[model samples]
Target: MHVTELLKDWPCTVTGGRPRVQVTGVTERAANVGEGFLFVARKGKRQDGASYIEEAIQKGAVAIVVDRPSLSELPLNVPIITVPDCRKFLSYASARLAGNPSERLTVVAVTGTNGKTTVTHFIGQLLQGLGIRCAVIGTIGIFIEGRRMEYDCPEMTTLPAEYLHPLLAYCESRGVTHVILEASSIGLANSRLAHCEIDVGLLLNIGQDHYEEHGGREAYIAAKGRLLHQAHAIIVNQDDTQCRQMADASERPTLYFGAAAMLGYSTDLILQKLAIPGHYNRLNAIAAASALIALGYTVDDVADQISMLALPEGRLQRLEQDGVQVFIDYAHTPDALEAVLQTLSTICYGKLITVFGCGGERDKGKRAEMGELAVRYSSLVFITTDNPRNEDPVRIVRDIKEGFGGDCSTVEAVLDRKDAIRQAIFRAAPGDIVLIAGKGHEKYQQTATGVLPFSDVAEAEWALSEKTYEGKVEGGSR
Candidate 1:
């Protein structure tokens, strides 16, 4: 595409580069620049992107776009285009380049600390069962019409605009009617979902999961609240005060679910037949039903078939066993970890054995909190490693031990995740439920050195199959 075409609404001038250069691809990172690519020098939170201009030019970046339009330091013969906000411009430019696919289909974006994946999954299931063709973009993977699409991008859940718009375009081309996706707090604050025309936005519940990343809970809430502004209609949690306030302030056509309601369906009708466990999942179902109702489906149309909604993989997933039960769930946050433990505590006939760990390089504040929660619910707790990416496993375990407050009777530190899982499962007897948390559906383990192949369900199954190698995990995959 021509530079003239890409910078349609934004202010630009040819300056010293070619009068009409074509941009074969676009990127914010200078290291990813290749021949004929347009390098966008975005000013990030930690690093100044303008510093990499020479590096991008060295890698054959044909054109450059930046919010800071200064040519005194930059070399001559390169197009220097300016935009008011390069982060927002990146999303809009990618959308325009991808033929504006979000406008062609209904977009339902879900934002929350814990239930974003589950709510998105339930919405797709309900809408698809109602005869609407649907596609899902989430942490598990991208699926279009029930088929997972192949992707290699920087982000796993909320992708950057360059990768996101094209996938939305492909879903549009494949005859999809609705696109459901999970929007993270950091992703929304950075403007990744800026230009997408969201038809219905679901606010599951705001929790203090990324306090360190956003600086505090208020900033995090404000960041995720950006979705409410972009949405035409909102379906929010009436039971949560923060979510209710955010949705009410938007003043858009809003619907409510959970406990109270302006216009919502009763969850009891579906909970009677709902196969998925946990009280949180009951709320996820109501939120999914409300979102579809806002998209023109009647309440009666959604609730009847919503009982068939299955839990997303890695979320309270069950594994096969004879004497004891085992589960694998992706509950990394404090709120999520507590919720899963609380749910399992109710069904546990004998003892609840839990193995969980915190991800390094993230909000360190939640590590100790999760430690306390795990000990409060489980009879035995193994504080293991979960994605220790470039951080010392010993130091991470020490941080989690702080939550025990000098009483380590219930908590034990096992830096090796696989060993911790094996010990927990081996110790379980009849009527006991063993839970492997934190890295549920993840297939890799990131230590201080590097990433290695790992899977909780596979490890747990192997451990369980050892007790009696004939048993296999049945109906576990999503």
Candidate 2:
């Protein structure tokens, strides 16, 4: 495409020269620039892209798009386009460059603190079951028709606009009729999903999370509420007060989903049969059902299919051996942890042993709250390390211990995550349910050194295998 065509819709003034250039690609990172690529120099939180203009030019960046006012330091040899907001411009420009694939398909965006991944997956399952080809993009990585599309883990829940537009274009080529995406608060706040057209937006429950990034609860809620205004129709969890406020504030038509009837919105689907456990999961089912219904699917049409849909990996994933049931869940927040443990408390025939830890560099306030929940709910609480990225593992464990209020009898701080899982499984008796919280479905553990291959489900299976091997050895000796 010509440089003038890409900037035609974008608000910008081109200077340097009017020489027409054929742009093959667009990128923000100077290292990713190639021949005939348009390099966008936008100011970031940590580093400024403008600092790498020389590097981008060195790599054959044919044209430059910058938001910075001072372009005196930049090379004036190439066509320079100046815009007020480069990030917003990049979103629309990249979409245009990628052929605006999102506009060609029905895109449904799911957003919230928790349940974004699961709810997105549920929506995909519902769509695929109805013989509609669809794709999903979220924390579990991209998926096409229930198959893993990418082997590597995504760095964030939502892909950046530069990559996202192209991915949607690829999905369109593959005959995907609908696209279900997990829209994160940071993604919305950063304008990652600004260009993508959303047909139905699902807002699950919002709780205290990413406090450091958003500053406080109000800012976090406001950031999440951005989805409400972007989509044509919004589906929200009426049970969540913040979500309710978003629904009420939005001018778009809204659909409510939850156990309780709010404003005469019936939640008859909550009582339907579901393979997944927990009341929270029931709420997720309602959210997914409501999204499909908003898209014109009948309740009865998807009711039977709902029971066959599997829960997303690492979400209350159960592994059973010798009457010991081990459940691996990605419950990193205090509210999520409480809901998972509370659900298990009702089903536990014996004791509920919990092994969990807080991630480093995140909201420190949730550490003690999670600790208190574990101690109050579980019979035995094992505090261990969970991706203490660039932070002291011992210090993270100490912060979690503080939440116990000095009740160290039931709480044991085991810095090693594997040992924590081993302790829980090795000590479990018949009918006891061992809950492994945090880092569910995650294949690697991030630390100060680097990310190491780790899986909670894999560790639990190994521990169970060792126990079975030990039983065989002892019995054979006798």
Candidate 3:
């Protein structure tokens, strides 16, 4: 694509303007820039993206986009496109570069403190079941027609604007009719989904999370609200006052789903018989059902596909072969932990055991609250290590212990996460339910120094098998 035609819609002051420059790709990182690539510079949390400008230009960046005038003072002989907001500029320009594939595809974006992955997956499964070619993009990975696609971004829930637009274009090339995306608060705030043209935006529920990262609760919510603006239509959880408030202010068409809608409507069989357990999962169903209905499906159409809808990986996933009733979930936040614990308490026949830990450099305030909720619901609690990125793992554990009564017997701390899982699973008796919370699908734990290989599901399965083997040995000896 030519530079002039690609950025025709964008308001920019061009320096060293080369109207005939052909662009090959778009990126924010200097390391990713190559010949004919357009590098957009912006401010990041820890470092300014502009600092990498010299490196990008050196690596053969054909064009540059920057918001700040001072950052564009370099005498580089490239077509520099100066805009007011480069992040937003990146989104629009990348879409132009990718043939504006979002316009050709029906895009559905779902957001919340929790359930974004599950809800996004639910919508994709429903649409695919109904014979619509669909793709799902979220925390786990990007999927195109049921196959997980390998992209540059493995860390971001919502891919950055550069890679995101190209992914959308790829989806369109594959004949995908609908694309379901999981929008995180931070991603939305960063304008990752700026020019994608969302068809139906769904807000599952907003609970306490990422307080420190967003600087407070309101800012976090405001970041979430940005998705609703770009959406042509929106589906909101009426049970959440914050979602309701956002819906009330929206000028677009809206459909609401929650307890009120579920209880009031009689034909809602979609919520009752979900294969995935939990009231929160039921609410996730409602959110997905509402999105499907918004996209021109009936409650009956969704009801037919409801049984096939399952939770995403590590979401209250049960172990069938294991002797004890073991469930694993990615409930890192206080609200998520409380919900999962309460849900498990009802189905558990014997003692409920919970193993969880908080991440470092995250919302520390939720650590104690999660600990309190764990102790409140479980008969035995084992506090373990979560990805303590750049923070002391011991400190994180200590913070969690502060929430509950410091009875040494009631709750125990095992700093090593693997040992914690082993102790919890090995000690459980028959009819006991072991709920492993936090680090559900993640394969590694980010420590202060470096990332360590870990998976809660993997550790639980090993522990369960060992426990079963031990029982077999005793029985054989007897």
User: Each prediction's TM-score against the native?
Assistant: 0.93, 0.95, 0.95
Single out the weakest 10-residue window by summed lDDT for candidate 2.
469-478
**Model 1 Cα lDDT, one tens digit per residue, 1-478:** 8888777677655556674777777789888888877778887778977888889889988877777756423664677776777888788888887888999989999998889999898889888888888999988999776677786665378889888898888888888989999999988998999999999888888886878788888899999899988888887888889998998779687777884342545666666667777888877877887787788788678767776898888989998567789999998988888889989999899899999888888888888888888888999998889999988888788888788784578777888888898888878887899999998889999876788999999889877866532344333322
* Candidate with best lDDT: 2
The C-alpha stretches of model 1 lying farther than 4 A from their native spots are 12-14, 30-35, 45-60, 70-73, 260-262, 468-478
159-262 in candidate 2: lDDT tens per residue? 88888998999899999989999999889888899999999998898887998888887888888898999999888887788788878999998977778642
Task: Please give the TM-score that candidate 2 achieves against the real structure.
Answer: 0.95
Q: RMSDs, each prediction?
A: 3.5, 2.6, 2.6
Scored by CA lDDT, what does every candidate get?
0.83, 0.86, 0.85
What is the full ranking by lDDT, best candidate first?
Answer: 2, 3, 1
Clashing pairs in 3: none
Local accuracy of candidate 3 as per-residue lDDT tens digits, 1-478: 8888777777888887564788988888888898999998878878888788889988989888889898666787887788999888888888888888999899999999999999899888888889999999989898876677787665778888888998888878888889999999988988889988899898888888888899999899899988878899888888899899988878887777895474235435876657777888888888888888888787788899999987778888888444488888999998889999989999988899999999899999898898889988999999988888898888888889888755556798998999999899877888899988998888998987788888888888777766754437321211
lDDT of 2: 0.86
